[model samples]
Target: MRKSFFLVFLFMTLFVRTEAIRIVGSAPDYAGQRLEFFTVADPVSKTPVPFFEVTIDGRGNFTIEKQITQNTYCFADVGVYRGRMVLVPGKDVRITLPPLREKSFEESKNPYFNPVDIWLKVNEGNKKELTNLIARYDARFYQLTDTYFNQLYYRQMKNYLDTVRIRLEREFEKEEEPGYQTHRHLRMKSLEADLLRTGREKVAGSLQQLTPQEWTQPAFSDFLNRLFVNTLSTESKSAAGTRMKMWVARENLAELSKWTQDFTATEGSLSDLILLKMLHDAFYSGEFSSSAILRMVQSPWFSQNKEPRIREMAASVQKKLAFLQTGTPAPEICLPSSTGTIWCSGRNTKPFLYLLFADLEIPVCREQVRYLKTMAEKTGSKVEFLIVLSPSQKVNNTEFMSSNQIPGIMVTDTPNRKTGKEYKVRSYPSAFLLDGQHRVVLAPARTPLDGFEFQYTDLKK
Candidate 1:
């Protein structure tokens, strides 16, 4: 009997209630796609790492079960929709997302639009009072900011900020949820930063008083970046922004190197933080250059800091830059058309290629197609034009081919972005020209309007 009891005790001790997270979610309108789960790969870098992914069934139901050890931000990504949950180990979360078909005001490529939409909904449900106050505060900013040059406008905005801060402090005293408290604190900080950016010196002290913990959160880090940049821009309006432009033109990499060094030395763990944010921004901004990226990694600060995530990101940027240079062999990708036909470079015998990475929502994409049609109509063009789009974007190749009378091949790539990454396609309407041997004649060749027809003829020979 003692031996039997020992066996049972050992089993209980070894397998004692393993902690895990389970999530069930539905997005009825977004069926037949994946619900990708991500975590902050590094807190400082704030990079989303693929943790787990599941396909939403035809019925639009999906589930995720992950063994976790601590509280974490579980970010969900769909085609164009995104959501986040601060999940504790052993908690089961049920998520419902609201669609944000918000009309984009600019030709923007911001990826945060999805996460912000879900975050807005999350605040509305869990912190209704704070949400309502912020709503008023946001709506009133534009209404009042037209008179930003006036001192009276500053007084009114300060009073409104004070009220928001008071309510947040009171809620903080009563609130016990760590996640909600973090959200509230960060939101308050964001408001403070906005005020500070608009020449409000009264709240400057509040901005300078951030704790180390707050400095690490992505939201807070973003605020600091904007504050640093906008504040600097405001100071350099000597010639109404032209002075700043000239200064930037005069000192290119040195400006970036100085910013990295200065911010890194500002506070604890911030050296890595500031540099990482700059690199991350540059990586996603689609304006990345080899020299700019090389200057960042080869900086003295990078050697002194030696952060793993920072080094990794720098290496990736470097590799991507080197890979897409002119004369390098382009990475080949196989994809399927909307008509379920497979298309690939290996099957192509054309002597030249006009490769396009585009989206349906982008106006320039359709414009480029019309230009391609005009070129294709010209005689003796021994080139193959192919348009590749992410499945995340709604595009129908059959409908596209029929509507535009485009002669090129249309293929849908997966949202994994593997193809896009390989092609170094950062934004919509990015074009490339390749020779018959699959070499990169032009990594960012040219748009049709740029007289790519001439380059097309040149590459053909």
Candidate 2:
């Protein structure tokens, strides 16, 4: 009877030990496509761990079960798509990944893979799991690419490349033909290109021997070029010059330019608009004519939908230009100050008000105080210099006032703290100017106060 009880106890323990978490899902119409699964190391340590994977049967159903340690994390990757999840051992978890739509899976045609978008998306959900996954993938890719291809080091690039190639081949062997075939090929090609550029002759020869068909695949082409461009740009002699030349040579320049014009004209999404603005700033600054600006203003993207906010921005830009040229009255700033609430009346005798918010501990703040004192002495009639302290814990108002010899009415709106936010004072010693009518007369100034003066002489009609 005791022997029988021991056997039963052992059986129950085994059953509990074998219990697993199951992740099951079906692809959106998984008729032709096959699902692939794999796990990467925890990002930081590069330690290997078992992960669940399932390929859809003919019926479009896939179920992968993993026996996991409690609170352990793992990454799930499917073709170009990847996600991260944490598993509590003995509990089943279900995750339904949406179909791989063209919109969702589309890689940026930009030479850079632009990891920012992927990183942001991964980090948006389940931070701990995502962090571990990112660290793993980052380490893996770096090991695969940097260790093998980086030429600055004389270590055996071939050894690392060979290992990666063998691992990739084994992965290909396990995957179903023609479905995941393209993805594996692309990944290998990217790795090969990285190997070739390592300033190693043997690796370069092997890459050159690849067939025309292999070279022509879109995935392969995109991955190879991206790796090449990023690596070269990062490590090349005269990197800036090389990148500039490459940018000028790219066929997408016309498309990018047109897109910028359309987006600017139509007042598109803020994010899209910002990207176009940055591209324009990079390529067209100091080179684009006023005629070009006018052309951009007339593009369909700008013309089709006139957003009020965008219109306001354009008007504001025009106003800023006017101020730059002829010192037009700018925006009104009526925030509280340190001593008592001070309103810039704009009716002051001076043409401009040099409003500065400073922190006492900053050396730059001390220099600015000296500069303001000099300006007060020199441009006493032309500029009204006002210095405000950004109230801090370390600063004593009484001591600050006495030591700085601040001539203006020192003020603080402590409880509200509205002034700092209103002015967007991100750093100490930030300054802005106002016209005679308390209108903002100058652009937000971040640079040092020295050699900075405003004279609006040429106002555009």
Candidate 3:
């Protein structure tokens, strides 16, 4: 009996924890606080969705263990103090967050006051160098875009872009680390995306010839966005005006597929990118009916392409479409109010669901929240006017609400906010609108104080 028990215990010990990721960290100043880790599911959305969370002990040490199978880009976020990290499968990663000024959080005036200093030591790994390399590449991309996008040397732009690409290649070859080849590709794509986002007409000619492997990169999506938008700018919608619709609206996927087939015949396998691009444009444009788009994405036309990556892109697109679609059920959003009580906003019987994820440290959040208050007053009590305030020492919810004389439901998130992750809020003061069934009508609802006031009016029409 003793021998059998010993053998069973040894077997259990050997097999039980082989696939889990162990994270250990110390943030002395943040004792008794929570630390949340998140990963990006889709680079297009680039919203950090929560994986798991841990609470710091009285001694300022914290440990977290999560069974994560996928290798992904992840970050540790504590409201104003956020630190980025890359999480790989079955790795034990130790992160040490150094102390910050206790009063830094209270300085509401310095909108750019960031206090977190991240020091990561991944056991038996080289993630630090890899992450730093990615950051450097991003910096180079932003620098090159800002430098070349508006220059008189547009004729020599191709040469400048080539030089940047070559530099990136040389840097990648130097480290040439395994498990990080995808990061390099992602960086290259970012550079390309930013170049296209610059919208210089000449950039279309200068973009490096794309490979099938790169079709899934964020840069590819950006380039596709530009291409799709450029094509839509060609035709006028009415007889009286020369202005064309901002997006090329079609009745169904058949029309979009026809265009894709033509573009592919000329550009070869770029049809795959074109298809993904169209899907992106549809979602980002918010011009099309969700049901129509969902039906098209679910159609076999996306799979008939024969390229596995394109098929995978179609699948990914479908997941997001389902999540943000008109009839799909919304996720639970239970967060704490100023009274330290959790406000489960979507649980109640409100006719409409409105969520405003705000960060008062940023000026835009403040502006939007004030504007939201004005709009919410007009919306009446039937609509759940829930303000999901992300914690900031600079902007205390109780003080701000009282000082501004703002009323209604206010839900404050803990330092490690699950609400932000739940909603996938990337932009400051993001707005979401849901139907009576708590289905997302507008994943990101329009703001009253738009920079281009007439833009929303035009879109609504």
Candidate 4:
């Protein structure tokens, strides 16, 4: 009996002594501050461990202790800035964060702020180096922004592009980077290529001054090719594959189409195929018709497979195309509210439902609320408006709703970003309009109705 008791006591003592690795960090005061901590069980797992919180002391020091049985990952998020750290069992960890200044819209008032700031900080106080870095980074950033802008806001982006070109030319003349002569030749060649594509003769004088060597560099040639291909593809949506499409069109469309069909039939990766299909839909579909897009999405090919990534894309495509088709019911939205709880269903509502996700601190959302108030007056309760608060937001949803005289139901999705993901709302001031059946009618209502001076007739018609 004593031998058995001794063995049990030994096991209990080992269990009692078990302790986890501790992580400690300090955050410096810079603007409004809070440190967010998150951990993942493994590198492959995308989902973070729930119910973990980093404890912060009054002095800005924080600690996170976990009995890590396996490899664990952690990260600190302060505002928009993020830093990652990892800890293993039996390891001591400490992290120090650099003070980060809060970003402000006022900084954008200076036209050269981005270029000059990058030049000064990253280029080691070298004027020439700064200029070169700015040119490259700006070009890349604008290219990315422009690609998305064309699909969303083409005219506005075109006007911005013109302004950017003018700024680029003005800056190019003053730039004194080493190899100025060679760089200038390359720069002028690129500018000429771009201008020629624009079909503008105004820059003909500048184009005439380029050297032969400037046009031969592989980098310059590659850039020209990509720019031309992108421009052509944008001009003609029917062009599906990048290089393959060009080659196929030059050879034979029937053969190319058959090959693509066969490849898709094999069905290696549904996600990749769906992505290609989305691109195809964007390019080949002449105009946005709900029925046509819906039919393409609901075909057997899309429904046959089930993968998380594919499902997400399929849902997104469906939301974008057939959100408000007749006979379809609207998605149910039930969330917690300060008073108790609020629910929004298409059932029992007049034929229209307006859902708004607003951040009280955002000026754009504030303006949108005023427009909504006006809309409510004009609609005269014909429309139902629901405002949902983001969980991470600190503003009192009730106070904001009451003060704004917002007419719809107010709800909050606490702790979980379920509502946001359901609607695919990544940014603030997102709004959706659903038909009476609770089906999505108008999604991605990004443009404020007020900004456009939208009248009641717009929605009614």
Candidate 5:
């Protein structure tokens, strides 16, 4: 009986260790605020997938737990700053946030604004842990780089770089954790790349030699992304680039992959990844046919790739490019009005659906909505005007619409901001026009203040 009890205890301990990563933290200055933790789902896009949110209590204490199988990078938006940390499976982390510094109105409204990234204070962590090791190594690396920037860059001091590299290697030599090993190796390589002034082709050659799979590591992906930034623009001008464009034009995945391998001197899965990067980057560049690239992503070559990561990433790419473009089907929006009636885009009665996402708190959005009333009055039955509101905006919608004579259906998105995210609505007054079949006609269909009346008149012709 005693032996069985001990075995049971050990098993339970192991199960707990392998199952969850718990974070216990405090932000005394931000009491009652909710902090959402995010992890990268698709490394190439670096899209932040929200894992969980914890609300700080009156005392500014919060605890959250998430299931994970490996060391995962996690971050939380604390006011205008993003606090980041590496979470190890089975280990509990205790941290303290810095003082709250909220975002200004303009910053909050800016869609392209990024939060300042800062390392959270790990109040409870062993020095041998990957998080601690990485933090220490980065600090030293930054110090060394700062101390010898000019000497390394213009002076071409190989001896100085060697000294820095040796110091970093010696200090971190004992870290056997696979994640730490990859991070250290990539950081050292990046340092070498900088000091040696390695050209893009040489970096590409070095990337080809790297162990083919390190997609999960932030360091590896960072290096990969930096090396391939704007590759489409640069490569398309090359002699090989013309053939690559032809392959993409034909929606030929096989030839595309081959082109990538030939151009970069990389083989197999690495070349496939590089090609995906190129396709993803070029999607918004207007350098290639977006529709053709979208078809290639949805092709069987990617969907049935032998590598699971490639399949997953390709699916991610497809989802991102699927909507919001001209001729693509608009994302369905079915929301409830204050009067309890459900309004859906599919049930539109007009030949065209004019969808408007507006926040009343924003002056510009309010101005546009007023302009919309005039436009709606003139359109007659040819167009259906729909307005989406944020959940936080609490007003007598019926009174406001009636007062403004805004002839439109008003609906508020749920607290999750689902509609806004689906429409990729970042600013206060984003608008889209959909056709009779709910296909996107004008991606950002011009706002009423921006001569959308003339644009719509022309479209009606």
Candidate 6:
């Protein structure tokens, strides 16, 4: 009885020790605003899963304690900055954010706003921490790349590449953390692939040996994503690619697994991951039939798969395959309008609906809004407009629409951009034309400024 009690105590103690990490920080410029920290769950989709959030006080101070089972790459998202760091288990981190630099109107409405990903500065007291070490390594790596860019990338100078690897190895030597080790290995391999212009098959040959634990490292999946970008387009030209095509056409998971074994050591999670990546790329590459790929991912095998990651990723990819296409049904959005009336998508009374994701505070979006107003007034109920705004846009949606005489339904998306994500709105002023049935007609329909009327006319007539 005493032994069992001791074992329980040990397990409970370990659970507490491994479960949570603490981050306390200050961002004077962003006081009173909410800051969110996230870790990438799947690199294929690169979707960040929020781990913690804290609203900064007036004094620009905040604290976050959240459960984290292992060391992981994480980032804090602010206005136009994404500060990145490595979070080590059981270690307390204190950081200071840079001064706020808000996104410009052009950037604010840009669906593809690439934030300046800077390293969060660890406090002086935590200068010797793992996150700081990773930041330093990254800084040195970039410096080396800048110094030898032409020679390493263009000239393929082995000496320069060797110098880089040697310096990095020497500086980060003796670090025994498995995540950190994987980071170093994968990062170096990425450089080797670039410098030698190695084929994807040769570069991917190393993946078969990586343990499942190693796959959890963000760096490994990131490298794999880079290695397989547009894989179908390249592979389709090869003889073996013909066999892959045949396997996918038949929706044969068994045959597909057999094919993947040629690249990976075993028919395991890693192989499945590579296969998923291929399917994702192929879905977009126009090399394979979309229906067939969708059916394959939705197969019963995915539901019965033992690996949770595979199942999760298959679901994510399946959603993309199902909705991101031009003809698929758009995700329903129900949001409160400026008039306090709930406005939901797919109940449009018109023959067509122009669904827009925009931020009225942005000049580009406002400009687009003006053009849309002019067009909507001229079209006169022939085309309904449903505009979704980001919560961060601090505008009186009612007053703005009233003053601007903006037509149709105007609503504010949730603070997390839930509706925007459902539509995969990456930039500002994204517009979609949907038929009465709510099926997408023109994904990313042209902006009014870009002669949208021409496209509309063709569709109308």
Candidate 4 Cα outliers beyond 4 Å, as residue runs: 1-77, 82-232, 235-332, 335-348, 362-364, 371-373, 389-406, 411-430, 444-461
TM-score of each: 0.62, 0.40, 0.57, 0.44, 0.86, 0.81
Q: Judge candidate 4 against the unseen true structure and give its global Cα lDDT, from 0 to 1.
A: 0.50
The list of candidate 2 runs beyond 4 A from truth reads 1-132, 149-278, 283-299, 302-335, 340-350, 409-428, 437-441, 444-449, 452-461
Better of 3 and 5 by lDDT: 5
Off by over 4 Å in 3: 1-21, 25-33, 54-70, 78-82, 88-92, 96-129, 132-174, 178-255, 261-270, 286-291, 303-461
Name the candidate that leads on lDDT: 5
lDDT per prediction? 0.58, 0.46, 0.59, 0.50, 0.78, 0.77
Candidate 2 residue 250 Cα shift, in angstroms, is 21
| lDDT for model 6 | 0.77
Better of 1 and 3 by lDDT: 3
**Model with the higher TM-score, candidate 4 or 6:** 6
Q: In model 6, which regions exceed 4 Å deviation? A: 1-18, 123-128, 157-160, 197-200, 239-244, 252-256, 263-267, 324-330, 346-353, 360-384, 389-400, 403-406, 413-418, 433-461
Pairs that clash in candidate 3: none
**lDDT by residue for model 1 over 88-160, one digit each (tens)?**
5666666666663433534235432433424323333443333333333344443444434243235545666
lDDT-best of 4 and 6? 6
Question: What are the per-model numbers of colliding residue pairs?
Answer: 1, 18, 0, 4, 0, 5
Per-residue lDDT, model 1, residue 204, is: 25
lDDT of 3 by residue, 322-405 (tens): 876556677878877888787786676877777677887787777777775676566567667678788887667688877776
- Give every collision pair in model 4: 323-440, 330-437, 330-438, 330-439
Q: After superposition, how far is residue 369 of candidate 4 from its true place, in Å?
A: 2.5
Alpha-carbon RMSD, candidate 3: 8.8
- Model 1 / residue 231 / CA error / Å: 7.7
C-alpha RMSD by candidate, in order: 8.3, 20.0, 8.8, 15.2, 5.2, 4.6
Of 2 and 5, the candidate ranking higher by lDDT: 5
Candidate closer to the true structure by TM-score (higher is better), 3 or 4: 3
Tens digits of per-residue lDDT for model 4 on 303-351?
5445444344444555555543444655688876667845645444687
Error at 72, model 4, angstroms: 12
Tens digits of lDDT, candidate 2, 217-279: 334334433432232223224534454334434523344444433422322333223322333
